[model samples]
Target: MHSTIFSLLVLKVSSGSAMKLRSRFQPEAVGSYRRLLCSLAASTHSVEESSMKSTITKKSIKSEILRSKSPTRSPIAVLQDWIKSGHKVTISELRFISLQLQKSKRYHHALEIMKWMEAQKGFQISSADHATRIELILKVQGLTEAEEYFSQIRGTANQKAASLPLLHGYVKERAVEKAESLMMKLNELGLLVSPHPFNEMMKLYMATSQYDKVPAVIMQMKQNRIPTNILSFNLWMNACGEVSGVAAVEAIYREIMNNGNVEVGWSTLCTLANVYVKAGLVEKAVLVLKNAEKKLNTSKHLGYFFLITMYVSINNKEGVIRVWEACKSVSGRMTCGNYMCMLSCLVKLGDLVEAEKVFVEWESNCKNYDVRVSNVLLAAYVRNGLMEKAEAFHVYVLEKGGCPNYKTWEILMEGWVRSQDMEKAIDAMKKSFAMMKGCHWRPSEAILMSIVEYYEKHGNFQHANHLIRMIHHFGLASLPLYKVLLRMHINAQRPAFNILKMMVKDKIEMNGETSACFSSLCKRESARE
Candidate 1:
């Protein structure tokens, strides 16, 4: 029993000592642990110390830690260690460090690091992004610095890529004068400005309405022996339409024809047509469309829309119908706006029969479309004085789950008023207002004015007065609208005296224009009373 107790005591003491030794040698306590172990190991003969064994274990742990190259150290920590250890950073490693700094948008620090790299010698980092970053950083900070850097590229053997983005950046900033100067410098540098930059320069000059520069740019093509294709001619002709008359546009067209190797394209003809359209020469617009068709050997729908729009602008109903028929023949899919344009034109011209045919053909052909198309078709019907057909068409549209918008209702109501169907017009106007109100869109002053005019035209002064009051209530009355109201009352032969008195009471100024004509009439009425 005594021997067992001695053994147990010895084992418990050793275990406790081992635990304390482990706690001391933890990585956090490595310095303390090393010092204690070094001292103990030096006193190897001490009776209470197992110094030699502990020393061996601590040396093993130190070796293991030293062998493990961990990545968890902070950048500052690694840098500090490198400085303390007097380790030299290699060129490749320094480049990577610069890249890391650049990625963080620390360009100034990156430049300093790069300068350090250059000072270290035998290090050449000439990647595109590296060069671009230096230029971009300068460009962002100071334009003069960027320009200086750009000028240095001629002397540097960096293969002339520096001018490309500099030119592009200038163009993007719309620094046209600066870009033109850069273009001259780049051309003088004997670096062939790439096609993309060439196109950009062309667009910049074109946008500024510099038609003179157009020919000059094209002349550069000739001097540089750059091929002048159909696109080049088209660009010039399009530019001419801005400052030059039709004659100048035709001269460019003739110039394209004179250039035997390059033929005029459909796009060129389209531009000519657009120029004529702007000049309000409808026949010329049609002729251009026809000529393009002959040259291209196809009637493109784009040309058709342009021709139709031109016809509408000139109020050429026959031309519109011709274009509409042409559009219908060419079939894959068409925009509803295109068809609506034709329908609206036919309605405005009072061609009810042809308009009906168009709607029928549209419904028969197009399988899917929005409700607005049907609404437009309804408006077209009403505008042509086809009330019976318009009502039937409205029913057809509703059956297809299509809701008519306020414009459609307004058109039908106007048609009713024109036909002297005052009761129906009033009812339809109320229904339209209710629908607009439901959808959180209010009726415009124009719609209400139309209602008031309709009532006055029918000699229902009381109804007209009610509508004028409603206009005020709905907040639809503006200065111009108020003038329109005063005129309507005067034309209806109603007593404008009371309204004029009210205007004076409200302190609304009656200018010379209003008083010049109505003032004498008001004075005569007062004298009679």
Candidate 2:
């Protein structure tokens, strides 16, 4: 038998498949095989003194088998022969083969061998006995097939607590539905239930956005008398925040507060604030965010950033200020985002004087200003009818970085018009147009109209007409912007005939404003002609 086992091992080693060459015999398998060989060798000994020589011979055979690179014998046949000869091979040896087969992704073969081992005398395979082996199978193959095999032993009266990886497997497969059903089945049959499985199932429900099902899953856990932990509560809160909106989130908060043992953390408050913001309840969002800061004993820098944004969305000036103060408190120096928020909010509220003050404050602290912050301050300047300040800051940004961004140029152009500085405004617009030309970015029709309006506002018809020519040159003549120039001519009360001639020259379309303006300009122009 030993000689045949040796020959088989040699054959397997020499002509083995790629799979065999790559096989990593695990330590457990090696240890178990060694133990089996020792047990088989021990069985060859006799109680009589002279029979010790036979024991030594058996040890020599076992040693030879161990030293051989591949098994020369059929391990299963050798084990069966030992059992038939009335010697017991350890169950560990059977498990080693099962694991090896499973490791090779040969699940069907592994399962078959497992069944054969179970049918053997004194060969009871406990789930606890094979948890590690089964976990290996699950990792190598996958949860779906692993769970099918698990189910065969999982609900048996002899089964221990379900494995952790199996619980995680349910989550990975997004099979919370199956987990919920199976957990209940396990409990109904008086099986030892594990809380991890229920927790994982709840997590799975959370991942799939089926938050509505979480309460039912939690109830299932409760029915099974499994203790809920912090993770369970957080996932429940997250689910509520998703489907139930702020009201549900508030209820979750109340429950957490009532639980004296579990103090609320910063993340909980952040979540509450987020839900409140989503629900469009800005006041409630700010209030909850503030309370969260107090409760967590943390600064409100991050919270204030979100708070200010919500307020800005609703045009809540006072709320914006409050949030800004909180932000400043958190970070002593204002960030660019905070500065932009302040500038934008002040401009929208029509507090031009305050806006001017902020612009100057930003410049005085120029050493601390980020280039983006400087750009926003320029926009604020332009919006507030402060062209000179806008130009200075635009230059500042260019000196600090490169040229001002598109927004900076746009704001400056708008500011130039507001301050009745046409030539500089037109020059700025032309420069912006040139820059766009360089970058393969074109000014929209609206920008051209803004420039035309600037010229018309300053009563510079020739320059406005020149801009009209430029608009046509850029193939923007068919656009609606030329109408603004026609309207400007009529509003200027220029010679109406001359304005009409200009319109005819440009083929400008006439809308109500343009027609009326053109008629007015024509009456004046006809009198002059």
Candidate 3:
């Protein structure tokens, strides 16, 4: 027992030696070392438990998103369910879901997510949040409601967040007058306005070929003491390169390059190259592109693609291939967008085999599969007159659990029609109408024409009527579609008076197609007489 006690004392002395630094406060220490260890273990367990709970929350949120049938309604319902269940949804979580919705082009449902956040208890949304909501409204609603929303909420937010989004919307709609007036109104309010809005307006003018006004916009920026960003300067340089020559371009470039406050951007260099190209200075353009190439970030697929695009503009196929090879050498996380860009380039180059390989690589890896990517290949096949191949590939895609959208079926219909297979085209149309749920999913003119011709030849007025009724039911309007139905009825010697009445009730205007169909009806009646 003496020996055991001596050994225990030795161990205690060793441990005590390790604790010498804390010895000064030992009298004030609240717990023994064992108790302190227990507290630390408990703390670690609590952290692990919180981590597990967070994982579960994320899973529940995802599952909720997957549970709802409608994209437009799903997010809203899930958010409401969370609130009702006393689950705390973080802003980051909300933004993540909103980002997914935005990427999927589901603006209405994204808006619903924002709406839920706004309605949350004791939540004060930033101007940025309100601006995001405005952007969503612009997309799902329209310019009018977006403007109304901006005007109604201006008193509560900063000018940048409130007005800039609307200005962007106007730029999209090409509403020059409205954008200018809004800018003027913002100026009158004496708010802190940035050069970015003016830059956007200037680009709009440049796109519309109003080169003279670009300088005025730049002058306004200078007058306002707004720090002109590289992008705006690039736009100005592009416009001024023709009128101001290489000297002016070089002077400003040097100024921007020397300014310690200003950082030179790749896009700025690209714009400089574009200006050189416009001024008949191919060598100068090549030099600018070389400088851009030197600054090219290999990890960014878009940068390489942009370079490839510019090379294509210069008609430099070899340069494009070299840049593409460089892009392939980069080690990084390749996104869906990168795959899409590669596919697009390959398709443009008629490298179908390469495209398919690139496509398969993405197809195996991508979780959120978009049918549009598949359609690009489908259209490629159809354009090459490989209808059978297109159909077979489409079937393969569907069997592989691909989400076949309306455009997918539309491409199928178009391929059949292009091959003059009216029977198959009509069948495709029937399938399209059966599944048509929204305005964006309407069949093309070529698809509709194939159906109408098939109906006219088959004299199946019943089927034609059904097809027309379905098209209008989905809110897809086309004068040609209506005219074809009328013509088919007239040719079938069936009473299309009811069809005409339906058109009148639906307020279908009589265009050239409708008028020609009516003229055909008159000729048929006279012949019968």
Candidate 1 lDDT, 404-449, residue by residue in tens = 6776677777777777676787887877766755565666565566
Ranking by TM-score: 3, 1, 2
Q: Could you arrange the candidates by lDDT from highest to lowest?
A: 3, 1, 2
TM-score per candidate, chains pooled: 0.46, 0.39, 0.66
Total backbone collisions for each predicted model: 0, 13, 0
- lDDT computed for candidate 2: 0.56
Name the 10 consecutive residues with the lowest summed lDDT in model 2.
18-27
List, residue by residue over 1-529, the lDDT tens digit for candidate 2: 0111111211211111111110011112223323433343234222322342344344332333233333234444545555687765445545554545544565554554555666777766564444443455566567777677666664463333334456556766777656655655655565525445555665666566556666665565556566665555666666666665666667877888787756666456655666666567778766765665454223435445544554555566676666565555563555556566677677777666765676667666555546556666667677667677767767766776544655556677667766767677777777776665556555666657766766666788887877776766665664366566666656665444544555566776677866666566657767877
Model 3: lDDT to the true structure: 0.68
Off by over 4 Å in 1: 1-232, 239-243, 258-263, 273-288, 295-300, 307-331, 344-351, 369-371, 375-377, 384-389, 431-447, 453-475, 480-529
Per-residue error (Å), model 2, residue 194: 17
Worst 10 residues of 3 by lDDT: 13-22
